[model samples]
Target: MTNTMWVRGVEWLAAAAADPRACKREWDHGEGVALLEAGRFWDVLSVPERLGLLTLDLLWRPGLPVPGPTLVDTAAGRVGFLLPPDPSGGWVGSGLRCASRGSWVAVPPPYRPARYLEWLVPPDGSGTLHGPGALEDALQQANGTLAVLAPLCGR
Candidate 1:
């Protein structure tokens, strides 16, 4: 049952990526709700400040393979996706597991008061941690992330 949900979520991401309309809808649908719930800690931020956080969550579904390695535009800079090591002894690539840990630690670290953005992306594909031009970099990162994950969906 859990596997089915993961696969479905992955499929939804693929569909959203291919269609702009789908992307907009999904961004406000399942993915949006998931992100909002996980990002409870950032509720204090203004709408614009929270855009980056919402965008990052939209592009990456935490533990799901569908939205793997997303690039997020942050006040710092463009950063790739990264997931904290699951205490259970492996990567938490399941939506359930990832969502369960909303305020988990992130590598390269985030600025104060924005710890919720830690799981944005991994360091390998990330740009400067919080340098400059993060949003632009995130667009490119998002394309690359989707391209890589789309193929895997067929399997």
Candidate 2:
């Protein structure tokens, strides 16, 4: 999409976030389009501080594609979207799961702050240390990132 479209798309999302009772998630199934109403989720970012957090899988291997446009929640009664992952893609370490095409994995705010770094290393330092996985993994990563970023954002 062009820059204009990108800005417009974000604006649309922002608008949706303003309406507490209106929202939808749509997917193009090679047919026309499928739209699913998201209810209050669409209006989550109405607050002045509720920016979305797009959680990206930093650890990706060659040839694999990253799922994208991750949508997340914020602290100030708002929402935000995670920016898409880097196409060149960075590596966590050797023998780790990597991706050829990684997309933005949107998480939420109270859940973000720590995601920027913890994706590679776990806060507690346990487990297989995969980039993205079950709820447990996401919680660990998001919480860890938040612990670090919260202070910075406050100042």
Candidate 3:
């Protein structure tokens, strides 16, 4: 990547950091990843990888809206979607998790892959995020589809 493109990517990813300068410093020092505190610029909602992938597909359908930055932790088999800070706590049950108020997420540095984390949907740096309602709907639909397909897939 050219310097301009790399800078742009970093500019967007910096929105997630508790200290954008610290994040940039780590990357500048050759770190591939940083631990970003949640609930500072955004929160996170994570689901099992299978369900999250399906949810992403639904969210990206032609008539639907694309979600904000998303990350998948290959080692942990989890997918996390960034949401606006202080998301609805009602969505906390049913194997779903919301990382806010003190939680942290392992994030890759801008367009690059980290140890076990990669961006599924990179942020645009425009402060856009997944709406709680839309995410919930898509997740429910994905969960239902997975439940139906599990037996047929023999999983």
Please list the residue runs of candidate 1 whose C-alpha ends up more than 4 Å from where it truly belongs after superposition: 1-26, 29-67, 88-100, 104-155
TM-score order of candidates, best first?
Answer: 3, 2, 1
Give one digit per residue, the lDDT tens place, for model 2 in 96-134: 222233222222111113223111111121111222343
In model 3, the worst 10-residue window by lDDT is 86-95
State which candidate, 1 or 2, has the greater TM-score: 2
Candidate 3: residue 46 Cα off by (Å): 0.9
What would the TM-scores of all predictions be?
0.21, 0.25, 0.87
**Which candidate model has the greater lDDT, 1 or 2?**
1
lDDT of 1 at 110: 20
- Winner of 1 and 3 under TM-score: 3
Backbone clash total for model 3 is 0
Sort order, lDDT high to low: 3, 1, 2
lDDT of 2 at 97: 26
